[model samples]
Target: MYSVVFQEICSRYGKTYSWDLKSLVMGKKALEAAQIVIDVLQLPMSKEELVEESQRKLQELFPTAELMPENSPEQEWGDFWAERTGCAVPENEGLELLPEAALGTRDVFKPAAFTLPDDAGRVYSSLPAPLSRSPPHAVQCLVFEDAPNGVEAALTAGMQVVMVPDENLSRDLTTKATVVLSSLQDLQPELFGLPAYE
Candidate 1:
């Protein structure tokens, strides 16, 4: 029934959610599509509610769900713009993060995220200032690819590292270079301040 659900979503609100489901457009496009779906479908609900309701109904029909959404911060980025340095946040509030390999750009390893928020808002992906050098630091980038390992190393090296797991996933984390590794075992124990795991 996955096909059925996809078809329904496309046929019913495809034009509306096109920005959200499509792999191309970013920022305001997604926000608009989401808002359109909410309105046309009369889904008068908060961002969280909309996501939850869609998940519930979709699940009722298809036992095997396929949506792999990224992490979303509860922070209210209300009325934000995406023009300046840190304007990559609100526009990307509820965007989805997909797997790479065949879906992402070769310029980056992590999956790419799309959005529909305005072109002049903060999307959380672009942090402001010196901390923005996340991708340059060796251990920082490592922690990004392998968080637990990176975190442990940062701890052992006496280097302070604060991770903002919120707003993480495709665009933001890729920009931050802080995507969390899926399995702890995938990271070396040396990454955890101890000998490599055997």
Candidate 2:
């Protein structure tokens, strides 16, 4: 019974190992079934020191081959889905209930009070940054004007900050954080060795 069950498992998964099947499923009955196949098939080692040792012996006895590469991400998410949308599935913010409700709220407080330095202003990028695969640490500091990001400082130190200009600047400016990329194209994988899709 165990040997027959093992044969069925092997037929379905296209793998040639009791240990792999054992890892996928758990139980003594499954182990017993694998043993039966090992015993009847005269597998090289039913009791090797390690599974790799067992695999080596099995290869010698059976001349192992595979119909497909095991770790192909291509096999996981077909070509179209993999190539489509660069695989950055936009997260649903789940703000449907109060989507625009927060806009006119009284609780969303602005800075209570603040003053800008008379001599303070923002620095300008005379040219755009080119694409590079440098690691994030390569940049001692990053700057952006008003795109959604983290760790921003208000422009108040006499052009000591980097500015990213966009047409969609709101009347009430969030002049705190610095934007990294001037456009979405700047976020390409070729710039980071993580090119979207494959």
Candidate 3:
């Protein structure tokens, strides 16, 4: 969705959106991402203008958006927890912790703070008290991430992260992850001291 909107924006300036640029902006905050795009492409518009135009286009496209096939398990996991807890678990449980919320700003993009390198460790450090009666230390936590930024964030928090990167992502960007796999299906929980899948 972002690529689609970015392509449209870049096309107006006769610039093509490349995956390299996408990688840089992928996990950043909206304004931050917009600034990177503008600076890198040397676009004529300001960050705010780029963001506004992108948002307008996104609103029109989002209605027909479909969930990625790989994300189906996330929904299943939410449903499983909701069933056991007898409380509604939203599919996007961490939405409230997005940078937009933290910065008191609103945007169509919803990158969670946990995906931001500087904020990830801080947010993870604070999760224990509210979420558990006996919270484990940061080192005891295992994170599952699909982006390099997320892997960096979890590592900064002193947690091991299993990265399931997009196939097109550069190999050099994946070296920092404690573990890397092509898909979640390829992950063996037992390897990380967690229970084996049934």
Best prediction by lDDT: 3
Model 3 misplaced stretches (Cα beyond 4 Å): 67-139
Q: Give each model's clash number.
A: 24, 6, 0
- Inter-residue clash pairs, candidate 2: 120-158, 121-158, 121-159, 144-178, 144-179, 145-179
lDDT of 1 at 196: 43
Per-residue accuracy of model 3 over 51-101 as CA lDDT, tens digit each: 888877776766565543534875454334334322211111223332332
lDDT of 1 at 129: 11
Arrange candidates by TM-score, descending: 3, 1, 2
By TM-score, the better pick of 1 and 2 is: 1
Off by over 4 Å in 2: 1-94, 97-165, 168-179, 196-198
- lDDT of each model, Cα atoms only? 0.34, 0.31, 0.61
Error of 1 at 73 (Å): 29
RMSD of each: 16.1, 25.5, 8.0
